[model samples]
Target: MAGPALLLIALLLATLGQAPTARAEPNVHIYAAASLGDALDAAIARYEASHAVNIVPVYAASSTAARQIANGAPAELYFSANERWMTWLGEQGITLSERSDLLHNQLVLIAPRKDDASSVALDKPGELVARLGAGRRLAVGDPAHVPAGIYARQALQSLDEWQTLETRLARADNVRAALALVERGEAPLGIVYKTDARASNRVSELATFPAASHDPINYPLALVGTSPSDAASAFREWLAGEQALAIFQDFGFAAATSDAH
Candidate 1:
């Protein structure tokens, strides 16, 4: 699979109009993966209105976010699209206690609605690969570095379709980018998170990888070492509260933790 060209765009509101050397707000510094941009914004708004303080969120890939935190990026909270990165932080002793799996997502195939008559179908699992027998383009995140892509690749392997479709694959730097390719009709179909597929009307879901196809897709959230101990605990509690869980469900994510006492 060939990688897409770079097109860096700022998606975070707080990071906009601020240079790297500019003054930063004294609010909680949150380093989140890019995929969470939509969900985090909704969560932050409710949190600030109720809590009376700002929480700055910096969005990037989960791996990139982890690297920044490891290099002292001044992040008080770390929310990753996958748990592996958070597990890495735990290994480095940067995770505070009371870690929680915040959400669960599935990998799915999306295509332009106009292409609906084609071989892609949500109920049929290997149909896309069967249809793209030779060289139709298929977009996906770069499995080498991106967690979503990793899962996408793992799922394809489970279906025994990776090798057959390898030549026609167009790899993007992240899930959003891959979605962009399909939305633009650059590729007939793309592999992206189920939430992302639902987020856009330009594309329709073609198929979903079975939950048993790959490892569990767990999104874990934890307080980083830079946050105040008290505030960190408070934030974690609020995140799992009724308000936050509702927001998560609205954004098409399944709550990973049970509130049952």
Candidate 2:
């Protein structure tokens, strides 16, 4: 009886010793602009392959993301499509660290892939309106809150065509949404980032907006919490490095220059 009892005890001890231990990887939450979805996903995948951290990303309009963070969202990192929202977060007293411009983008006019019309000259007065025709609308992000829309508005205003097109615009929640409208043929035209147009096969680039027509299109990145975890800090640093910049460029985003705002 003693031999059998000792054998059972040894078996149980061995089973317990060989059991896998449960460990939770550190989680880092990222809130970024919708336009960054693809590029950021690639970056996250690359980072995770070599690290033990779990990354969770939320993509939305910069305004929506910034407002959510101000409302106490659990985002440890915030990447805005423009500096306005980041500055707004600062005004709201959201503690930020390692803030800097991350990338630059160009605004473009796009049409459905099947559209055969010649590229419309933005400088030619009435060209855009004629392109829209009767009852058609130009799809764009909501200029009131979306960074892309604001830039579009600035460009149109610079061209002296805002008043004519303002009421005929189809406002969307984000730049991607605007791109979708044109891709789906729901709107004959759309204004979006060059990267956004490039990502979709359903849309064709019509023209690139003049950079001087709007404020420099800048994407800003920052750590959002009072004290970000070491993993989050490391990820932020990695994103600003040359490897990440190369990845961003592959996705059609230009590197932000030191003098870029």
Best by TM-score: 2
Clashing pairs in 1: none
TM value for model 1: 0.82
Specify the poorest-scoring 10-residue window by lDDT in model 1.
1-10
Error of 1 at 136 (Å): 3.2
Per-residue lDDT tens digits for candidate 1, residues 1-261, read: 123322233334445766477553347777887778898889989888877457789988788888888887888888888788888877776755566787888889888766444435534556767655456788988887788888988888888788867677888877888999989988888999999898888998877888988788878777877435565567777987888989978989887864221
lDDT of 2 by residue, 1-261 (tens): 999999999999999999999888999999999999999999999999999999999999999999999999999999999898999998999998889998999999999987475687989998888888899999999999999999999999999999999999999999999999998999999999999999999988888999999999999999987889999999999999999998999999999863322
How far residue 73's Cα lies from its native spot in candidate 1, in Å, is 0.9
- Give me the runs in candidate 2 sitting further than 4 Å from their true place: 1-20, 258-261
TM-score of structure candidate 2: 0.93
lDDT of 2 at 61: 97
Error of 1 at 147 (Å): 1.1
TM-score per prediction, in order, is 0.82, 0.93
